[model samples]
Target: MDLFNPYNLQVITFIVLNGILAISIYITLATGQLSLGHAGFMSIGAYVASILTKQADVPLIFALLLGGLIAGVIALLIGAPTLKLHGLYLAIATLGFGEVVRVIFLNMEITNGALGITGLKSIGSTLYDWLKVTGLTGDSFGLSVLQMKAVLTLLFLLLLFGLVLFLTLRLHRSRIGRAFEAIKADETAAKAMGLPVAYYKMLAFIIGAVLAGFCGGLFAHITTTITPDDFNYHKVVEILSFAVIGGSEIVWGPLFGAFILTTLPEVLRVLAEYKMIMYGAIMVLVMAFRPHGLIGTDTFAKLFDRRRKQAARQAEEGM
Candidate 1:
């Protein structure tokens, strides 16, 4: 019915943000790298975008893109040297980086020292005003102002998902993607085959960072306020959990995980404190049983192939 109500819209917006964060980690996971500090890159993007928009009156789109680019560049700088480490070592290094970022923000005068920057404009407010200017509000639609804003935000997030999905699929089919898979399968063998393993891994890490940064920019615009605490270690772990639980083998897996987990808190509101325990139990069960994730790459590929074959057979019968 009124799914675009403020409460529902808030939930939808969080889910969208979580989905983007999940995809960011998924990119690193695909390259067989476990980066646990995505929230740091996110903070970078959020602060940069917020500062630009609030102080300089930069357009939201430009601020977001610049934030993403800066995050990607930072990832390159961090990844080139650190990507050499594999497994737990890399995770630790990234985690440390995230902590360092949080600490820096905590003490920095530019970030207003822990209190964080506030009073930034919200996308919903901006959009609502713009629509009113264009005479698209009120009796034109049987919906509240919040509903219209929620619908617009949802549409925008969906558009973003499309772009991300397209680029991810394209990357998976390209030579670089294959290179990543090759290294993931066997680093030594991939190296033996003359592939630049380090470069490909760094590329994946940078891409993931850029995506997280972009999400952060959107987050700041939507929330209209951000604090250093928002991107702490716990947040990083949550993002990683979303990726692992969602099935980082494919791009859709993390998004699916983000949707389910982000909505679970609201769905289990009646349980209150117990909801967290229930969430943990579910995660434990999933890890114990579906170690590969709820939707592994093989399962999805086969399902799509089966559908394609079925469609082809039907077309031939028609002919």
Candidate 2:
């Protein structure tokens, strides 16, 4: 199969981006804090990165980092007070914040008032040019310029996702991760045990914001155009579904969820207009059968253990 075909490349790119966004939400959910305003942080990052790259001619890497940093700062500021709220209240407050961000961008002249900034430089083209200048392109690669660009973009995104996944895995075993788990399991008990509940929650919130911001930057560069409408409440719901459907018990769950959800529609393309209806139904069925998600704690272990026991029993009976 031609994985680098434009259509396939676009689908893969979106899956990676959604995986990153899913991880961001999972980070907050790990701390038992449900934040529905990640789209707001993402918008902040997208606009910041887009402006810097388009106007100041900054490098893409630097622009993305700066965008994430700015998003983290905003998360820190708002998370201080809003983090105090729990459950549905927190979700409502965050949803409101996302609306406020969209309206602000819609009215802001710098954002071009809903017209949005277009013609942003494509990272694929930049990478292809760099490779060409470095004498790495041509017959040696056995690929056309377009194919090369698509491969480069995919590699870059995969590298970033791998880095994020590595850090998340390390975090899962870290002291801070344990604190987050404790808080999620029982906030009152965690506080009683002398853990800094508020601080950990804030830290998780900021980290999630930074991740979403980074995702926004990557998304903007890939699409080469971004508007306020790109980061709406619907976007938030989509992101949250990734974490929920994948299962919040482990970091891999959300990524897996993102992969399934992102590609399901494509797989159902034959269904045409009915694809989305099937997609929604599948999600509902999954939720009804596995509320903890497809990969809850010990899911794999139990499955493997059951298989091992069955094999042993069968062997004994045969003997």
Candidate 3:
């Protein structure tokens, strides 16, 4: 069992890409907002970086950041005016924005449109080499290009989850999180209490977009080729679905969702036409049973709490 097998390698890559997109939407979902335009940021990041690296001869690292920045800027521009809206209306508006982005890219001569971008350089082990040089060698073994990507994806997931948890927990424990919860619970009362509803909502949108941009950059590197088809409206829905299927409150839920969902399609591929049907059935089942999602606040608390309670009961019984 050589660890460097290509199939294993591809699976690792898929996990990284899936993890990034899943977590990207997870942030937005945490804010209780559902966006269907996340692919807009993704498109912006992919096209920009691909063009920069392959066309303008920019360095890979710089191209990635530039692409992310471009996407972030676009997201900011769009989010500022739109986050104030609600529900399906917001989803519709975002869906339109995503399509518009896709259409524009499709029509743009530079993008090569529906043909998709190909022949880009693959993201290699250079990043991993740098990590080893910095003394990550003890517990962190050096990796092949694919393994490095998987490790990076895992690391990025951990980092993003930690940062998001820190912020949300701080807010949850503070006046601001209360305001957000208040808004989620009852927007009118929250507004009456002078909560900055629009401001915070917009803040959430922008931050979520930035993360999406970062993920898109990594995505561009991972695929080493891209197309408008890759970041379509369906893709946006997929991102949202992962966050939805996993309860948004679970710190690791979206990643788990990504891992499962990403792997599921492959498992079902043998079913051919029935694969999509099975996928839909699975999702419907999840939604029907896990309404608050797989890890809502009460649910997540109870999970760890259950173990502690069991221990206490055992201790009393022993006494």
* Candidate whose lDDT is highest: 2
List ranges where model 1 is wrong by over 4 Å. 301-319
Local accuracy of candidate 1 as per-residue lDDT tens digits, 197-237: 88899899999999999998999888889999999988987
lDDT of 1 at 159: 81
Candidate 3 matches the true fold with a TM-score of 0.81
**Residue 197 lDDT in candidate 1:** 86
Report the C-alpha displacement of residue 213, candidate 3, in angstroms: 1.8
lDDT of 3 by residue, 1-319 (tens): 5655556556656765777677667656656778888888888888888888888978777887787788778877888767777888788888899999999989989999899898776555435555667877424554555666556544554565466557655755776555556666777777898888887677667667766776776677767788899889788878887778876774467777887788888789899999999999998999999876776668757888999999999999999
Q: Which consecutive 10 residues in model 1 have the weakest lDDT in total?
A: 1-10
Highest TM-score model number: 2
Collision count for each candidate, in order = 0, 0, 0
Using all chains and alpha carbons, the TM-scores for the candidates as numbered come to 0.91, 0.96, 0.81
Query: Which pairs in model 3 have colliding backbones?
Result: none
CA lDDT scores, all candidates in order: 0.87, 0.92, 0.74
RMSD of each: 3.4, 1.3, 4.0
Question: Model 2, 160: alpha-carbon shift in Å?
Answer: 0.4
Instruction: List where candidate 2 sits over 4 angstroms from the true fold.
Output: none
